[model samples]
Target chain A: MATTAVAAPSARVKAKQSKRFKIWIGFLFLLLIAGGYFIVERLVQGLPVTNLSSITPWGAWIAFYIFFVGLSAGSFLLSTLIYVFGMMEYERIGRMALFTAIVCMIVALTFVLMDLGRPERMLNAIIYWNVTSPLAWEVHFYLVYIALLTTELYIAMREDLVRLAGTASLKGKVAKWLTFKNSTITESTKKRDHKWMKILGTIGIPLAILGVHGGTGTIFAVVQARPSWNTGLFPVIFVVSAMVSGTALLLAMYIIKKKATKQKIDHGMVVSLAKMMVGFLFIDLGLQFYEYLVGVYGLEHHHLEGLGTMMGSAYSWSFWGVQMFLGAAIPIFLVFNKKTGTNVNALLTAAILIVIGIIGVRFNIVVPAQIVPLFEGLPAGDYFPTFNEWMVSVGIAAMGLLIYTFGEQLLPIEEIQSSEKTEG
Target chain B: MLSNMLGSKNMTEKDWNNLLDTALPDVEKEMDASPFDTKLSFNMADDARKVINENLNIKDFHKKYHSKLLKEFGEEVGQDFASGADEPAQETDGVKWGMVIDLRKCVGCDTCTVSCKAENRTPPGISYNVVLEQEIGDFPNVAKVNLPRPCMQCEKPSCVQVCPTRATYKLKNGIVTIDNDRCIGCRYCIVACPYGARSFDFGESYEDEMPGYNDVTSPEYGIERGERKPGKTPIGTVRKCNFCLHRLERGEEPACVETCVGDARFFGDLNDPNSTVSKLSKSPRAFRLKSDLGNGPNVIYLK
Candidate 1:
């Protein structure tokens, strides 16, 4: 396996690279057309163009927002395992994890901007800081976190960028511009980058867990009006599930990207990553179980109604079908079963299932809590995302995928095979 | 000017002091000419020390000096102090705003709804208040309850808590206000409100039904925000009942409370125990909607 480092990125990498470029371009064109339609509709009719109403104030946009945030937090946490904790076995995915984190954050913020009633006044959230509001705190945390992630990412790639700066390709040009003229790869510079990466990763661990995603969860959980969301454990579940989704997404992306480029898969690392993903999933499931159990045991009418709306109502398919079956059952089976557990294809399927299932989890979190009437006499909300809302969400997600695809094509995200051996 | 008067006063220590001081000899002439005994006057002066300098209650001071002051200053001055000190029993003033609604007085005709819309000139889908009609019990025995829902304007408003921009907050006067200029219109406040009191102004209007519906924006919070237009302040913002703050500024009651033909709405300061709302709030029949939520809503209802 150590000798395999000498092979380099062979003919397989080159062939797959050209095809992925074409796929990326086609996807981008489709996203542009879809985006153009929704943009015009949104401009003309405002928010009424979607199914959103005064009752269901948050919908697909919010779900997508949390989804992307989970991805970002998950990927960043994985990157932390390598940089901060010095987990050498998982080091191959470190920079790639950072890159994915950055892309996911971009996508998440875009969803929020699209969802705003006054997108033009989005800056007002920053201009007027409301210390009491969790959303306000989230806005500030996001800005600071983004800057840290970018700086850390730049440092992580500095050596590679310096090396690539001399090449002839467009990526080489980007590297040249990014590195500046006086760039040098020295032992001291490596030490400096390594030290900074540790510091940033250390800071980011808490910021991501407590500030970014947990605060995002708090934005909902703090609302006493929504009984389902008003729990101390809610934000904890949010962070844990974020780890679940993040690990699944990164693992899925790593394998899919390698396979598409015909690069050799790191079998041991994938198995370990899969194990970590399932472990996080089990923990997330335990938290969710307790959350549901407590809600059921309380038997408070509103809590019961909310739980019923999630588990047994017309919309329960999202629970049983997507959230439970696809998100948990199928992925758990694929990972644990003796026959399919080791196969790369089966693990990939499990990874994709987990990603889709998490979307179900996010939807269930938001919609079920809201569908139950807040008061006895008030009408229960009946909501489904309108076509425009679904299309807009799809378009945005496709746009994110396109960017990630193109980014992988240009960046040196794939690791230079490490030569160090543990021969006894 | 008073040196001649001091000369007439009998003094032991005073006499020695007066001899060294620059004063006329007849300073106490009127006091010496008094028919009352000098020893009596000296004894009375000593007692006046206890009354004036010591810890004497003013009532006791009046009781002790009543006869003496009356004999000396006559009836008019003493009587003047008595009435002046206790003029009028304390009465609080100013507009302590309040409202009274009789559930027995209400027919649930929805007149308040029409009046509120007309007064506020609200755009389409934005109702400040509404009467929710629900039937209770079975078939022949069913009874209809016409519950009119308005902004609770809770002392602990959920809308205020979840507002990301501090766009919405509660005023000391018991009114909840939203600064449309500051509202990012995330509608999180709307969702968080248990009362279902909030509405998002999706920039819709009755332009097809009415010619000038979009031609004017309501002057909320006393600011004449001018014409309703796309991307305007209130157009893409959250709105709800403010007890008609603009109308309240004009010394008028809220249009819903005023125009309820059934007269079932009550409004006023819950702070003043003597206020109509305060008195009504204490009634055994008076209870808040969802009192268990701990929102401490200002609005109270009579069953």
Candidate 2:
């Protein structure tokens, strides 16, 4: 798919691209409608429409919530590497990362709303804050983090938004609406924008790590009843895994979007980013290894039971098949292999696989510990998300992609075109 | 009431005492057995009865008892008395209700579980109480231990700690209560509870088996919710044992405690050192389930 897209003639691609976007959007709309039906059915009937029970109160929705939150945190932190730390080596993808972070956060919160049994009352989490609850803290942190991300993205694109304000294009209308009429690409304004981006990015670093993603990990880790998640290392592991997923997603997105538009792929940046992603994965795996080893060695019954449920029980296939082989080992081999390591298509494949693998990681984290009943002699939870859950997830994901696609077109999400850039 | 309405309000004080004594012969007998003056006990009990009925000021009773209690119990009780005994009444009056279950005496007939179901009127998938039957050892050496489980109502309740909204909270009486109206049905409390005490109300009903099952709710927490309906406050929210709070408000024991056939369960105010529950809780034989986790479960069990 990557080769064909890259090999396509520019004139033929341009003719078909507009129609393709329409068809893609139409397909996404159908999925959204279908999923919306189940969403409404769930709301009206309450939680009974799904297979969720008291035994496993959280299901696929929770897993996806954490998955997207991890993605958002990871992507935001990656943008910090470019804007804050001045790693201009990978500057081309900086705006994309920030935009992806925003979209991913929207998707993550949608998943949370879907999972809520009383979604309308969700604001109560804010109104009546139980300061002890990690979940409550996460709600507040997510809001502030999203606000910071939007500000950073806006500052990063301010120069482009100003430059495009005079054009007759659709993007021009949006650029005019977004920027002040007097906005200009002067050296002073450019300097001001850069400074603000740096400041926001610097603030965002801790917000993404400790407040967003690490706090998400704390939601699970603080549950003393689930000993496997109770370790201090759990939040650290979550931060590392976020880096892994974020880098992989951005690398894949950059490659796909470039190939679709028949633009030049920055081979040096792709290769280096892929290497960094795998590096983060290795660290993540090492931390998880120690987490498991310590948990097993301590011989706590529930911890052991949780590990057993994840690795050896009926749920083990997801652990070994999706997360380890597809998510880790194969991606590592593809990135490290001599012939394929430098290949753009292989790296893209590796990136996509890692994203899927992290989804498996999320499911493994949420479901296994719950499967082991809280007490001995009690019935263990048996959970598989119903068709309604899958539909809701698919719909929410399509909504995120649609937003990203339109965002790319309407805003200067890409490095502003060279033709347009020369004028500015 | 009809006689009073007919303007025949000329009952003498002696006549009223005769009527009260006749109406509650059992209470009269119990109060008479105590060594302290029975007249003072009756007077205090009479004032407390009026207080429960909301007919008299509770502060008036406290003021009346301040000097009398000091005079009767002597200087030993002075410390507690002098510390503003005239203060307005407390919400449960320093009572931390707890339970002690003797495993040796429990026959595991599941009477407590059944009574809890009947009293709470929980749906098919939800039970406020359950007796877990676990077999110890292996083969011929096996011994069965029936662990009757209910909400621990912990001093530091894990559910209360993790609740996103302060919907679920530990009342002053030590019963952890869920204000269903405020609950968002996030189920974080269910996930956090170490004892697995909480359940999501799925709006399921025994209506198919017993007609009108959804007609009326059990007035849990003394709030009279009329019907069991889909997507109601509790239907989408979480539910758990509030130690039969409605029954407690009526000055009656929880249905489970009342129905324990083995007499294994003992319920009283743990804050009162003289209460049976407090004494049993201190016993070397008494141990709480997973006490080391530091939730400080109020439910104690004796081997």
Candidate 3:
């Protein structure tokens, strides 16, 4: 009688939860449909639809591209902290991190495709790799990194998938298809999968740091024409910032997903991860401070102009308002404050803000330097993403979310309760 | 159209030959006015056709005509023959094409910019060359200067260094060129170029302003790209001054160099010490823009 009384409320909650989930999916689909129209329009018209000119060849799409790449690199490295370094405290978030990395990479590459003047010929970058080109090497590296991520994620999910293959949910159906026919969740199979996960994650650390994100930074740093980006510290800052954004994204995702499903918030993990994310941010800001100091102290004209544009011109709001205040100061305060630091809700807001702040950072990185002309007398570039560009970015980002959402529903991205106690 | 097609389709080889015979002028009569031997001209023509068709080796043809041409043409062919004796196909070798612009003589008229547009048929927003005008000093003491900016065709081009597909490369003659067909239109080259010499062809045409603007595209790099249309090789790719490569091939100066109203532009082989550009490059007054970056710009400026 007591069990029936308990089951009744639980059933109602489950129904309510499923309905909410459907609405979320429907909302995303509507956005996708809306964004799809503009995506098609931009593709048909080509790059002229955007405000990008020869002077400012890259704009919002590139900023977002690098932003997503940073997220992917940061999250993958965070996953490595668990899988490779044996940090069991963060084990629950490991698969989700790997999955987010893959999703973010897809979004980043899609942005890159959208930015290309001739999107159809993108394979030419890969087919004819100029060995000296960091962009070419990055193209190859991103593919390898994606492949490595997928393999690691698959191995990480192996035991769960094998266990789920006999069940009747959508995830079970996917598990049946994804797993080997006679796959078993034996102790030996578990050990092998764990070993493989460790091996792949170990390889991924350097690949993510140097080949993926650092290489992306090098794409800007190697441009001697843009003195603001030409410093050696540029790539290092990129790796560090990736850590800041990555940890924040995972923290926010954990909280949001748990809230949506009405699960118990992992307060300890959230607080600890928030601290680590802030620590990384402090380091990122220090490096960035030094980077700007050296650039200003050098007193190079183009470099100064770039910094002026980023910090003192019309675009300065993005640098100070969004990147520093919202992205850094507020988050740092929230994470450190006595009352708010341990609060799950406060930490969630801080995580989301940092992610948004990193977007501002990315825009500051890509745009301001180009605003200062390459030559003294050449007309300086004026750029803003057209409505079409914004819509296309919206569409691409919506598409990534759809993939992640469906992937979560159909795969074992979330931690299985049975394995958690045993593993811990 | 069908009738025209059928008429040509039905014409036999013998009929075509007969028609060709009637259409032709009398070769002997035409040659009668010339002082040179008609037999020699006819023999040379046939052999030249053979050389063109690869039926006879050009070296052997040159050997056969060497003495006769020298005997007939005298001092002209003697000098030409002596100069052209070695490396007949390699005249451009050791000839690093460079341009020396005398800024003092420039009036900022933009004639070179105009002529460049007309010659290259570059669409709107795509100028291979532009004259940058600047005002120096504070308001009352200001002095105006006109700098005609063209592609530097650098020895170590940053564009070539950063291009992902190796689609753009420096040629043997020192002109940096683009394989537009291979360019993915990533525009990385534009960002990497310190001089801002490159422009992206946004597939724009001047159809609204002028009719038939898209009817012809300049045979840039001597490749006969048919028209300036969307989805074409150069339409969605990075483009820059190639020193008018096709014009250079035809033994003509770049349109900008030829049409400079101030007579400020000099185009010549920099490797030849006697060339005017070579001498100007050696002048203390001559300097390259952004020389500290080590691009080794072939475009020299004499102030």
**Candidate 3 off by > 4 Å:** A1-9, A418-424, B1-93
- Count of clashing pairs, candidate 1: 16
Q: What is the lDDT of residue A235 in candidate 3?
A: 96
lDDT of 3 by residue, A143-245 (tens): 9999999999999988889889999988899999999668988888888988999899989999999999999999999999999999999999999999999
DockQ values per model: 0.46, 0.56, 0.54
Global CA lDDT computed for model 1: 0.83
Better of 2 and 3 by lDDT: 3
Clashing pairs in 2: none
Give lDDT tens digits, candidate 2, residues A144-223.
99999998888888888988899889999999999978887888888898898988988899889999999999999999
Instruction: Please provide the root mean square deviation of candidate 3 (C-alpha atoms, Å).
Output: 18.2
Q: What tens-digit string does per-residue lDDT give for candidate 2 at B164-251?
A: 9999999889999999999989899999999999999888889999999999889999999888887776888899998999999999
Top DockQ model? 2
lDDT of 2 at A231: 98
Model 2, position B61, has a per-residue lDDT of 66
Docking class of 2: medium
lDDT of 1 at A337: 94
Residue-by-residue lDDT tens digits, candidate 1, B201-251: 888888889998877777888889888888777878899888899888877
- lDDT (tens digit, per residue) of candidate 1 on A103-159: 888889988887888888888888877778898899899888889888988898888
